[model samples]
Target: MKRSFGLAFALFVCTFTFAQQALWGGTSIVSPEIHENNTVTFRLKAPKAVKVQVTGDFLPTQKIKTPFGDFDGPGAADLIEKDGTWEYTTPQPLKPELYSYTFLVDGLKMNDPNNVYMIRDVVSVTNVFIIGGGRADLYKVNKVPHGTVSRVWYNSPTLGMDRRLTVYTPAGYETSGKNYPVFYLLHGMGGDEEAWIALGRTAQILDNLIAQGKAKPMIVVMTNGNASQEAAPGESSLGFVSPNMQLPKTMEGSFEMAFPDVVKFIDKNYRTIKRKQARAIAGLSMGGFHSMHISKQFPDMFNYVGLFSAAIMPDNNVKSPVYADLEGKLKAQFAQNPALYWIAIGKTDFLYKANEDFRKLMDDKGYKYMYYETDEGHIWKNWRIYLTEFSPLLFK
Candidate 1:
């Protein structure tokens, strides 16, 4: 009887150990699983974690009205934890767009390990997934002839550094043996040269547009607008710093004075059309400001100019010598009879008033320009849409 009891106890211990091990191990987890209905389901395996939550751009932002002003409130959903796994499904179907998300496990923010696809913006890194079709399909990698995107370092005597820039050469660029027109694309305040390629989905847009014959096949040069930085973060010895770091006075120095060097380098290296009519310049936010100033500074250099939600500070308010003769500069630029001078902004943008004031100034000066308005506020969605609309209008 004693031997039988001992054997029974051993059997119980073996069974209990097997059950505990099974709880911690299982098949691989598939996160951000997209359903046919456009709903998304996210899952994470954190058996030991006490709490788990998920937040993403797809989730609606909670707005808080404080005495100071209205601001974005925190909106995160707690995940259901069961059997060593956490999961959450969106209550509503997500719209057709590329959405980024992150997981918060016990208050620690992390990217989804199971989702290999990720995107790095100027400040944060997050995993990304796309849903549905239509406009979202334009941002995807379709079966079409693609372009080549390269990060090239060039001499910038004005900035006194070897700066880096992103260049895009269209399909058949090498074997076609044709000199293509050039587009100088600039990024926003916090963005680097990689911004357009990573977040803007520039290559995909250009490829699809060119394949459809909606836009001319052209070379795109994406320059680092930060006058103080020698290169994008991680590519330079300066090391990576927060995007909100206090910029040096030189950081705000004249990009117009230094832009000629960029043009000179591209002309010397690439098979460019080498004329104002074949050159275009465009940017978003601070880049829009740069586009305005740079085109004004060099009137004969660019025939097409696009300002995407430009941060247009009035000449009277600016202290830089670059804007000292703003009126004369703009007059000279407009006198050149450029092909297209386009400006676009969202109606609810914080800079709406500033843009309105700028447009009034343009009207007062009798300068000709094309204006476009959208439905949203200052955001990447508008910028991408602006790019899609603007590219087809260039070098026609």
Candidate 2:
């Protein structure tokens, strides 16, 4: 009986160890392994899969056609099989940046089984890895003193609901007990309070920038730009409704009108500099549109304004005073002499023409503004870069 009990106990321990190994692809297997040369190797244990491929932002983009037009999208690389595992290594060293990828097993899309790091962008989820020794290092947590990121609830009388926001108080905020400036970072269409923190790496960027003395230590308030949704899907009482691209009130005037509620709530709650000179507003794509309209509608609210790949013109059919009087609002906004009115867009963005028209309109009006152009289209990579660049110029 003693011999049997001992054997059984040993067997159970071995089984448990094997289960743990199988769950995360034990010591023998690793999905994404970044090499010293900056090349990446991806491996998958797909003994049965006839074909497997890896797709990610690291690969060159291929032109994909959509209802709008052809646009560049992430391409796939085929993996070679050896024994029971499939593997592939990039031929060239990838640039030092954060990249997300997924495995395609026999034509089915799936996340990496071995690597657990991942983030959700509006509606899609993908595994992510960073190649450090460059700008991507800012996104990684280092030895610097990190700030406190809080999910705070605020009552929005204008919207008639309690909404959620992700706020980042710089390091030493609680201990120092001094009022700091605030930067309102909005999100693009289909994004929520968590978007900038997740996809844009807002917290990491601000933390690193502040530590390096490149940016002012300020509070960053990331709000749920979708006026109809109180928060990110599954975050509110919405009950796990899958996020989609067809979010309502994304660019409507409702969000712009209710923007002051967010500002007032932050000022009243946090130790904040309540004046316009200390306030900055910026966003990407749809969020950029909101920032532009919000700042113009209340020019005294933010002395610093940034439009990152902004949808310059409002939909002609959306009848609202916020979208009305295109030049009149700018005239009032500029007359106050805001510290900065900046615009930036990707060269190949579908909205490139619209941004150019916006620039032309500002030029014709003789408005003093700054413009920046990049190589990519309307994507998060550019948005992340924009945030890094824009934050340094704020409150300086």
Candidate 3:
């Protein structure tokens, strides 16, 4: 009996270890046999932490402030740490779906230690699961025509350095052997060429949009906006945004100078239609600022200009003569041609007023442009929606 008890205890330990490993290898966390409770609970163990906050893009942010209130015990309650674990319970039940979440420890980003669900590409991060609960149809990869992304090298005349750009070609471009319209997409400060394709999923979004007949089939070029070789400066070797590196005085030139060079290179290398209407330019955040600056400056080069949550009007604190020159560039485009200028902003975006105020300036100048206000704020989730909505109208 003693020997049998010892063997059973050892077996139990082995089984428990195997189960933990399986949970990470695509195994379900919740048992299907047990019906899911709509009132879900999240418990995170970070004994070293003093404060924790749960941030996610689930609904119109107006309701997010009081989200906990809509669920249970208290309305809009802050998650509290108990027994060295931070826990929050949903007032109601959650549907089956996966949600992206981040934890804030003393205002720093740290992944959830307790969550088992995770996805990895360049980085291994955690995600939450609410089984049978998601907008799976819209956020899914389908068996539709796909797009190809390539990393290319180029020389920047203004910065005096060779830089790299990532370009995406939609399906049929290779087999059809025909020139297609192009969209030059830009990234914001602290972001690099990989930001759009990786975080924004530009390729997937475009493929789905084109397949559904919501967007035109076109090529997208995502380029590094920084003129400096330091790239994102003080980030990791992968080069993400961090402290250090002052904003460029001649940001317009630092980024725009590379445009003509990239365009000339693409025309020489790829089967590209060399007409203005066949080309479009757009971006988000810093990228959006690029769209506003580059499109306005090179009106004869591109027909459509999209600014997604952009800082169109220059910041008042900017006193540099180089920064002031942007006004002259905008004036030139306004005087030349202002067709197809599309501006979109999330209602809760910090730049919401920036976009609205800039639109008013465009109106005063009689610029032909489109303005959009959606249910999101300054986040990748909203940018994904913008790409899906903006791409279909291009090259039309």
Q: Give the best candidate by lDDT.
A: 2
* Model 2 vs truth, CA RMSD: 1.7
What tens digits encode model 1's per-residue C-alpha lDDT throughout 1-396?
999999999999999878876874444788989998988999999999999999877876665564422434336898999999999999998889888889999999999988889988777788988784877877889999999999999999988989999999999998998999999999887788998998888999899899999999999999988888877778787776566323443224457689999999999999999999999999998889889888998898999999998877533545776666878989899988889999999877777888999899999999999999996666677888898999999999
How does model 2 fare in lDDT? Answer: 0.90
Each candidate's lDDT (Cα)? 0.86, 0.90, 0.67
Instruction: Write down the lDDT that model 3 would get.
Output: 0.67
- Per-residue accuracy of model 3 over 331-373 as CA lDDT, tens digit each: 7776766457788888767778767888787788676778777
lDDT of 3 at 95: 48
- Per lDDT, what order, best first? 2, 1, 3
Write down the TM-score for model 3: 0.72
Better of 1 and 2 by TM-score: 2
> How close to the true structure is residue 35 of candidate 1, measured as C-alpha lDDT?
91
Model 1 misplaced stretches (Cα beyond 4 Å): 1-27, 48-51, 62-74, 239-245, 249-251, 314-318
Worst 10 residues of 3 by lDDT: 67-76
